[model samples]
Target: MNDALGEPQSVLVLGGSSEIALATVNALPRRRLRRIVLAARPSAARDLAVTTLTAEGISGVTAVDFDARSTESHSVFINEIFDAGDIDIVLLAFGVLGDQEAAEADPALAVEIATTNYTGAVSIGLHVARRLRMQGHGSLVVYSSVAGDRARRSNFIYGSTKAGLDAFAQGLGDALHGTGAHVLVVRPGMVRTKMSAGMPEAPMTTDANVVADIVVKSLRRGKETVYAPGPLRFVMAGLKSMPRSVFRKLPR
Candidate 1:
């Protein structure tokens, strides 16, 4: 359950090892958080995440086995977590930015991206939503991307997946309206993380911690949607309004 101030005292992060997710955990009121569940596939990174959070003075930090790509098991996986205790927040943060060129060349690769980013998310997202609504309170923060605002030629495959995810998250938010269960869709531009370390830095690029701050603040303000750096909201709006003919030629 949340604290007296309505700050979440418990959290469930789908991608336990995600830098941004971990950053959000750190950004929250550490003293108020009593239970922190990090769900991700078994890995050394996941283990390190648990150890790191614990060392950071966050109590009740633990990791559970969770495979986002394994959609069939999501229902059982999610229910088991909720059965143990009520969750105050669920962060749907699992995703892969597949090699665009490789994915386009190999259909198998593209399918993998779609399956993980879209199908897997939909499967787990709905189950999480059900539990949130049933419990009658909690926040679902979906880490969507600015790339989803409009598909660019360079990484349309990844962008398209985010597009689908963004739409699903928005609709889910609407359905959960007035139920005390809400959703916050986060659309971040290029962020400095292991995921984007090698990629060219985009305009208004920020870091994982910055995005984390935005997530926490948005949740507090009851914002349905937000941009990480805030300015990207206007940037995305302009690009969204621009004709595709001219938009396509712009640098990705």
Candidate 2:
């Protein structure tokens, strides 16, 4: 599974500390990857991520501070990466799960969710896409969710954020349709990741490893969209068709 440059040596993950993102990277051929750039906010948690990747045999690991709110600096951040060389792949995995209640109380909170989940990602990703296109190839994997299919009252704020991200990724995919660069939009059902640790688990909940495996397979196959656990595609279809009144009543 060596890439053209001797191996899939260089990789970039925007939310390098994300559990799902980390799982996906681990699932990749470690022997083929020489370096992994993990961009995340500085915190004790991110420091632990560096140690974990190092323990997993990912030797060339670098952590850079990236604030999703600072969309203006996204270009500079990406330029720094390309200044080195063509990155094998870039995963836009950064996002925040805002408290639904808080968002409802304060519109600013909702705006924050939208900015972090959608605007910030798209800003940086579009830049990366252009770089990949110019270089003639690379993979961009964006994390969307089934909740984006239809906004549910239980989690409409979060759902809406995903909806925007899903749409942005799709449009980006189309815009780069003929370019050698490609985009993969991943929709996974509820998972027990740290993001949703306190929430009750949902049906067909998958592990981070499962999501990672699907992403890898999707990239290999050049799939435009992938649903984790696979069956979620149909599940979401049925859920989306359900009456809103009924949908809202269903226990999450």
Per-residue C-alpha lDDT of model 1 across residues 45-78, encoded as one tens digit per residue = 7899889888877788889998878888999999
Q: Weakest 10 consecutive residues, lDDT, candidate 2?
A: 1-10
Candidate number with greatest TM-score? 1
Please give, for residues 88-197, the per-residue lDDT of candidate 2 as tens digits: 77889998888999899999999999899988887988889988888887889999998888998778898988998999999999988878788999998887798989
RMSD to the true structure for each prediction, in A, is 1.0, 1.9
What are the runs in model 1 whose C-alpha is more than 4 Å off? none
* Per-model tally of clashing residue pairs: 0, 0
Clashing pairs in 2: none
Cα error, residue 165 of model 1, in Å, equals 0.2
TM-score of 1: 0.97
Q: Hey, what RMSD does candidate 2 come out at?
A: 1.9
